[model samples]
Target chain A: MGTTGTDIRYLVIIGIAVMLLLFTSFLLALIFNQRKKLKYQQSMEKLREQQQNQLIEAAVRSEETERHRIAETLHDEVGAILSSAKLHLLGIKSDILDERDQQLHEKGRELLNEVIQKVRGISHNLHSNILKEFGLNEAIRHFIRKIAQGTVLHATTALDDNYKTENPDNDISIYRMVQELVNNILKYANATEFIVSSTHRGNELDMVIFHNGDGLTQEQFEELRYQKEGLGLKNIQNRIILLKGSIHFTSGSEGYRINIHIPVKSNQP
Target chain B: MKLINFIRDWSEVWALLIPLIIILVFKPAKKQLRPVILYVFAGFILNFLATFMVEYYYLMPSWTYTDGYVNNNILYNLHSFVRVLFLGWYIISVRQYKFPFLLKTLLIFYLVFVITNFTFYESPFILSTRLYAAESITLLVICLFYFFRSMQDESDINWLKHPSFLIAAGISLYEVITFFIFLFFYPLHQKDISFAAVTMRIYTITFVVFCILLALALYKSRKKSNLSGVTG
Candidate 1:
């Protein structure tokens, strides 16, 4: 071949090489670009999850704080006034009153005492001072006593004595969650018998509520918790999340059961 | 009659005016589109001037000086240089951030090649066949890159309606067909004048097709903007 033929042949080879180089570069860019996009999506999903957890924590804290404030007001202001009224009634002399007046004084003293007791009970229910002073075991016992007085649910609890949490806030949240679950069993489960069991295993506290009646299905539980009428269940869920706990709901032919596991130490910063 | 033949021979030069006029009349809404339209218009003016100079030299042979000053071939070389430069600019702008460093290095190399061709390998008075071949190959590569880049884009706009895709398609088609013609121009022209003339006609036809595609791109861009304006 002549010089011109040789040059043309070289140009053809050069053209093929250029095309191959571009094609390879394009493939590499595409692969890297997709990998980068996937990473970005994962980071975005993580950020969204973090934001949701923070919101739930804030809500649970605010609700607990409000409950404490109301309880304090009832105990301090209302309980004091009623106690004073009962003391004054007690100070009235029998000789200064006719039979009818004496009878009225006695009745008035009895009513004042009942009102004082009722107010104190309401305050205690709102914020359990027993849970704060004593701990989770005493609080559960007190709760069972309160529930046993009103209903025929035949409630029973067995909490490990050694089980303790360093954070009272976390304990209150866990207690509230258990309280809500028990209330749910009482109101909806229609069970003749209910059981509450708690144990400390390793760094985790496991609490289970088991009842012998038909309860909500998993789908129903999820759906209900999102509904407007399921505020109580939603509150329980938020408290569990605040305590860095996990809850499982299971239903069988026998009954429904709720098992919750909370870490002894809170994971919150 | 001779003037008619001259016009027929340079039909691609005249075809460039069509897109230039259309783009100016429709006026793309995007500010970024202005550079592309301005370059196309510059190309049209350049082609028209080159054709005119070549025709004038042919008609007035007596006016030509023996001292190698100004001629048709030099004007053709200048036209090719400007066309490659503008097309490169368009591709680089469209690719934007996605344009690879390797392509940039290749562009620098192409620039150097053009300078060397004009200065040493090929004189201004001679047809720079090698440079034309290199331009076609480089442009073909750029057009293919545009295609691959467009494929990777997640834009909702229909690919068929995309202005850049349409322009790339047109450029790719032209380059694919004309590359071999440019590669073998010197040898073929040395062998037979008829073969060269036939190849030139094919070049004119492909050039006309490319201009039509560009005009369509401008029209699509204008329509897209109008639709967005009405909906927005």
Candidate 2:
């Protein structure tokens, strides 16, 4: 009986030890398998995000291409036609006409000149040739200058001279976001003073805009961004997301301020 | 020999304190964790009482004895019942299984079975091997069901860090480790008392590990809730 008891003790010990070893192995397996699954899920999420960004880039690029086409057609074809019409109208012998006819011709010439000037301004705004040639800094300063000239708003820019364009695509995205925000301010803020500033710090580019007008807070921007009427703001957000950047809106004592930060990726090779 | 006796006498009782202290100190106030809190608190109390009864059953009232022997088996029997009840409640409340009616029915049936089995066939003062087997099997089934249901869930939760997964894993490991020993405990004890003691020590070791796992689960749960509170 004593020998049998000793054998049984050994057997139970072995059994429990085996059971514990097996359970440990099983747990480790479960953890590793689940970790593998999580990795796969994360990669799939990254792939989906990459695909979405590609779609947004394609849409924005196509829109820019269409704008360039329209601007070129207007500037080259329509402007030439209008200029020729002006010269022909001017060449008409006004001296041979009655006084009333001469007045009508002069008025017609004035309207044609105004139309030509307006067309030129529209073409310049749409084409973005200055942005392509001069980069984001000059483009933004030029935009602010145009705003200051064309509206009652006193707009100013203090862009960083050290800021160099590493990627034109990213620059275009930044320019578009700034353009949209400025437009929003002009259309709604009703304030007179607006300022745009940029600073390049190491590998980060920070841009801030201040306007002394009624503007959006971060919460309001979040709320408005999901509404149907906020498509422009949503597009701006999507572009910022593609650029892997962030935009913050705040209302200070003076008025409103927007801060944008983008990580500068060096794609120069 | 003294070490073995000490371990055999107090391992499970002391192990319960680990998770109990964690729950008390951390105070995971989430509604989903309430059942776990109650389970650990109640388990600690019951286990402490059982350990005390084992050491001092001779000084207790006659009603606590059977056939002139100090018998603390009733406390173990009671723990099995509480174990199923609280753990089952945790599953029902947290998992919200699809066929909740079925699980509730099973709980009711198990409760009735425990009462009837103790009243008629088995003296609660003696180790109720039947109750241990029934409890282990039931809990094992519930733990397996939890894993299966978690498999079907589409949420991208880290299963390793998930409190529910940890609880299920702890429970399942304890159940599997002790199932056979508890199943044949009565026969083995009668055949060779020394062998039975050895098996009980092994059970004690597993119980200690199980309690540590429970403590970890509670800690993880608290951390997760705090994180969500900050981010939400």
| Best model per TM-score | 2
For model 1, name the residue pairs that clash. none
lDDT of 2 by residue, B1-232 (tens): 9997886688778898888888778866567877778888888888888788768877788877777776777778888888888887787667757887877787888888888998889878777888988887788777766676665556787766778787888888888878778876766787789778777877888899888988888887664422110000
RMSD of candidates 1 onward, in order:
16.4, 5.1
- For model 2, the stretches where C-alpha displacement exceeds 4 angstroms are A1-4, A81-117, A150-154, A190-192, A250-256, A266-269, B1-34, B48-73, B89-113, B148-158, B180-205, B219-232
Per-residue accuracy of model 1 over B1-232 as CA lDDT, tens digit each: 9998977867857788777877778877666566568668777776776677655665545444336433566656766676666676677677644748766776788899988887877787776778778887777777766666655665533444567766766776677667777777777667655656776787788889988988888777774422110000
- Give the DockQ of candidate 1: 0.02
Residue B157 local lDDT, model 1? 36
Per-residue accuracy of model 2 over A217-237 as CA lDDT, tens digit each: 887888887899998888788
Query: Model 2: which residue pairs collide?
Result: none
> For model 1, what TM-score does chain A reach?
0.80
